[model samples]
Target: MNTLKWIKRILMALLLIIFLLLMAGFVFERISRSIAEKIKPDGQFAEVENHKMHYLQQGKGGPTVVFETAFDPAGHLQWYHIQQNLPKSYTTFSYDRSGILWSERGANPKTGEKMAEELHTLLEKSKAPKPYILVGHSFGGMLTRFFVQKYPKDVAGVILVDSQYPADEKYLSPQLYKMVNQGLPGGFLKFANTFGAARLMFKNMFPENNQYQYQNSVMPALLYKSADATLEEQDHMKSVKTEAAAINTFGSVPLYVITAGDKTKYDSFIKDQKIKNEMLGAWDKMQKDLLNLSTDSKQIIAEKSGHYINQDQPEVIEKAVNDMVEKVSVQ
Candidate 1:
């Protein structure tokens, strides 16, 4: 009888502990989200598509330069340096991707081809110029690559930053590929898109192993916007197919590629010897593949910079871009 009573008490204690932890987590998430909402963009616009797209435009010249921060957590403000110092001759405008940062949600994949089409429509509606230089990072690189193929006559030069093409699916992990591939139709897209669902995912995934306070902004906050561009559930899949089709169409337009350097170089945090070796080996293989892919374009690796190479080595990116512009201009 005494033993049974002790077991019941222990189980009750554990349940109470779990309940307290869940409540604390809920409170912390609310606080973090309230903080990230405060960061502001340099300029803002309600795009012709009826979705708001944030932007920052500066300078003036022959071929206007447009920068796309189509990656996570950022709006138009991520171009802190390029907007400040990309030469006086070129007009530069950096903007948030739809469904990211301050922009209104619009679509999935947000391919360069579809985005380029939208921007072109916006340009026509807003009377924005054409025959401009295009710059993109990561996924944005895929977009720029597609734009050059789709509208070769409209682009003068292109610069792609730390763009992860030719790399295997290992970097993104099979699970993420599964989520993006499976969950779109599995219904996580519609459900987790609201601000509440996003807060839960971002906070829980913060993993006690890594620490980054949501002091300002988080990638998922971009989920607050609605996707007006998607008509059907599979429109997202169509976007993927459309982007793949665009890849089959790369043109001979002036091109520059920036290969990124991963920081497994100084990574002592990796405890397992086998995982460390695998990381180092993977980084070396990616470097070799990048060098081979840089044939027509000027390719340089940004050292110690991981996925967000532009944010890590923006000045290096800026110089490489300017050099490419001068070289292509002379050609």
Candidate 2:
């Protein structure tokens, strides 16, 4: 009888300890979120499909340049330096998709077509003049393509900054795809964020790249919606690809494909010599294929950079946009 009572007491003690730890985590998470909200960048909000969408705009007048970002917590910040460097004679805009950064999650399904539509509505409601010169990086490249297909009249030209291609699944090894698709389960990530685990990981992740505004703007988005949105997009990549494949030719849309020339970057992600070689070959083929989409297309290789060319070679991006703007002016 005494032994049984001791076991029961120990179990109860353990449960109480866990309860206290969870409560502490919840409190910490709430405090961190409040702090992040206080320091976020100054940006305007517009209602799209009954949800608040955040955007940053600069400069004035035509032709408006729209920035579409990757599946990153930094949102529009990915294009910050390039956007800031552009001449004020042309207007520029960058935005967080719904459930990203400061934007509220909308009711529509998280598919590229729906997102393309939401972007159109957001542009119209915000009074950002068009036709826009769409600049897309990584996953944003997919969204930009969808936008062009759905609303070709809204876009004057396209600049793909190391964009994601529709046939990526065909080229990427199963191991790499599996690693990307299942890196971390979203439900677990959401649970971790709620209990402050995500915040701790985020702090460790960005320890070396400290900037006041970057931390202020990115941390909240990382804690709030980055995981869920990322997972949803990955889950629906098949549909996104299908939609992307629909529009084979842009019919002289003035496309500019900026490819990262550093093939060695894949060395870190892929260990197998054979698979890595295959991926590199496939990557080069796809980039070349993107050039054929528009008759007036040109390609620029950012030889010094890796995947994030905007970060490594902002000058290249700035020149690309200015060149596109100049081309549009003559048309």
Candidate 3:
């Protein structure tokens, strides 16, 4: 009888502890969300269809430069530094795709084609001028290509920064490929973010030397949105190849393919040296192929940079955009 009573008491204590923890998590989540809201959002929203798309615009006059983000959840924030430094004569804009950052969740099947179409509408509604220069980084490169293929006359030039090729997966080993393509379960991320656990985990993930507080403040909001968007895009990866096939050539539109020079950095992620070399070679070949999209295209190597050339060597990207603008002006 005493043993049974003791067991009941212990179970009750455990339950009470869990209930308190849950309450604490709820309070923490509210606090974290309040902090996130205090941080200023980068841009305003343009009504596209029934949803709102967030975008930041700066400068005026010259050919408008539209910046597309990588697979990052933070969206427009990725181009904050570069956009700020752009020449005042040239207008620059950066925007978050639907289901990212401040943008409302979009309709189902968020494929590349759908994304590009939405962007077209958003630009038109926002009154951004025509004959625009499009710049895409990483996965965004594919979207930019689709945009040009769909609306060739609207675009003045293309800049691909460490962009993803349709054949990019072929270079990776089966394990590495799976790891890269597979995303975390969206529901789990949502749950963590709702209770502020995701924010806590991310806060610890960054090193002490990393002083980027902007990212930390925005991570909680990005946690679920980024994961869901990434998974949705991964589901439609096959469509990218179809889009690439349709655009056989970019005509005379000036194209710039910026390849990262530091392939060895990926060695840490890939243990085997030979496989790393093979992956680097495949990436280089694929980037070269991107140049074939236009007769006037050229490839520049960001000598000291890795995948995030804008972060590592902002000068390279800035110079490339400036050069493209000058070239477009002459034509």
Q: How good is model 1 by TM-score?
A: 0.67
| TM-scores for every predicted model | 0.67, 0.87, 0.86
Off by over 4 Å in 1: 27-39, 107-112, 122-128, 166-249, 262-296, 328-331
Clashes of 3: 0
Q: Which stretches of candidate 3 lie over 4 Å from their true place?
A: 1-23, 169-176, 184-188, 204-216, 219-227
2 or 3, which is superior by lDDT? 2
| Per-residue lDDT value at 183 in model 2 | 42
Clashing pairs in 3: none
Clash counts for the predictions, in order: 2, 0, 0
| Candidate 3: residue 78 Cα off by (Å) | 0.4
List per-candidate RMSD values in Å. Answer: 6.4, 3.2, 3.4
**Candidate 3 vs. true structure, TM-score:** 0.86
lDDT of 2 by residue, 235-279 (tens): 777788788877678778999999999878787777888877887
Q: Which candidate, 1 or 2, would have the higher lDDT against the true structure?
A: 2
CA lDDT for candidate 3: 0.79
